[model samples]
Target: MLQLCRDASGAPLAPQGSVVCIGAFDGVHLGHRALLARARERAAALGARTAALSFEPIPREFFARGTPVPRIDDARGKIVQLAAAGADLLLLLRFDAALAAMSPEAFVEQVLVARLGAREVWIGADFRFGHARRGDPVLLRELGARLGFGVEVFPEFLVDGERVRSSGIRAHLAAGDFDAAARLLGRPFMIGGHVVRGQQLGRKLGYPTANFRLGRRTSPVDGIFAVRVHGIGPVPHAAVASLGVRPTVNGTEPLLEAHLFDFDGDLYGRRLDVEFVAKLRDEEKFSDLDAMVRQIDLDAAQARSLLGVPEARPAGACA
Candidate 1:
């Protein structure tokens, strides 16, 4: 079982002892998994639970609220990935003004020591935390000596001579490079959200759709693509998805519109994981509704041909 905590003031998760790993873990990529695996190994050796401490809004998002800073994954997606990556408990500390005001020492004493009761702390080589980003591996070791917790910092993770990072993944997605993005993410980049009501435009055009609102200003990727819809049934359903502001409809917020291939049922309000397989084309506006519908038909055919039914599985699955 995975225990989830949102409040630092809540009951202690690991009263006995815990091996703690902390990071934004935005995509819970291969680099992040390596660190979590080490925590799992240490926890097994020490007879302790593995706990991951991460911040909501990822600090960067909170700090750059009005700016168009897209995320590799959403909160719910991050939670699922963390548990799959071997975290027994997920401590999603809410990043608010109060937490932002807390100093490094206070954060260690109150959150790590009191709430989590951490026995071992693992972090990435360049991980930074606490108010004004004053916390570091050296500081953690100093606190560990006094608090009886051990600290381990991993070196920068690299792949193909480039550091594996959320930013790198975002860049690849923006460039419509699914292969490169998959390499960095360790899996297909996906948008996970509940199906929502749409304008029925696709239905009117003979292409029924499942719409998902991202609740974010921008997306890491914005285009029409061949995709797989997961968490909808026992098997992944093939689909064609458009991620953009629906220029033809004069839509504002970026939305994910998935048109499942030869499958239908009520999906509204049901959570679905839309996994990116291949970029078909960039989102574009048509001269009219008929033209738009024609384009969609062509897109569907291309997607079906590209996906070829049995999509090759990525190294990891979206948990």
Candidate 2:
């Protein structure tokens, strides 16, 4: 069982001591996985539990204020990925004003030492934290020495001689290069959420869709896509998805709507994962409802072709 905890001040979670890995872990990308692996390895050797410490809202997002910060993975995805990475406990601290105001020494003392009872702490080589982002590995090691814990900085995780970065992955997704994004992510780029009820506009347009809200400041990927819908059955279903604010509908919030091909059933409240296979086109505004539906027909046809699904034949037509 993995424990999800917030708040820097709390009853010590690991009285037996723990190996702690700290980062924003926004995407839980390949680089973040390496750090988690190291933490788990060290914890096993020391007979301590593995704890992953990250922040909710991410520090950058919290500081961005009115500006929307693109996220590679949403909040739920981050927690799910972290737990699946073998963390015994997850500390998702709230990145509020109080947490941001804490000094480096105080953070180490309160969160790492007093709260988690960290025996060994791990972080990425360039990781920084605390007030004004002044804390570095050097400062952490010095604090560890006085606080009776060991500190180790994992070497920069790289791919093909270049460092892996969340920002880089975001760029790939933004440009609709899912192959490049997945190469660094170690898995297909996906967004998962419980299906939510929408305005039923798609159904009225002759394509009912399962809608998933992108519950973040902004989504890294947008536009129409050739995709697969997973977690509904034994095999993933081919689908066409749209991600963006519905400009034609006068909407202002980002939403992901996936219409599974040749399928019909209720998906409300069921969690599903939409995996991007290819970028079909960018979202566009149409002159009228009929025009919008016309483009959707094209999008669905293109998506089906990309996904290797045969197009639906006219009723009673030759095979």
The candidate maximizing lDDT is: 2
Q: Against the hidden reference, what TM-scores do the models get? A: 0.90, 0.96
Clashes of 2: 0
lDDT (10s digit) by residue, model 1, range 1-319: 7889899776777878899998988889989998899889999999989999999878887888678788888888888899899899999989988998899999999999989999999988787878899988899899999999999887788888889988888888888898898997889888888899999988988889999988853578888999999998898999999999899889888889999987769999998899899898989998889899889888998998887854334568663
Candidate 2 residue lDDT tens string, 62-161: 8988688988888788888998888989999999999999999999999999999999998877789899989999999999999999998788788877
Best by TM-score: 2
Q: lDDT at 168 for candidate 2?
A: 91
Reference-based TM-score, model 2 = 0.96
Q: For model 2, state the Cα shift of residue 105 in Å.
A: 0.7
Model 2, residue 235: distance off in Å is 0.8
lDDT of 1 at 8: 79
Clashing residue pairs, backbone N/CA/C < 3 A, model 1? none
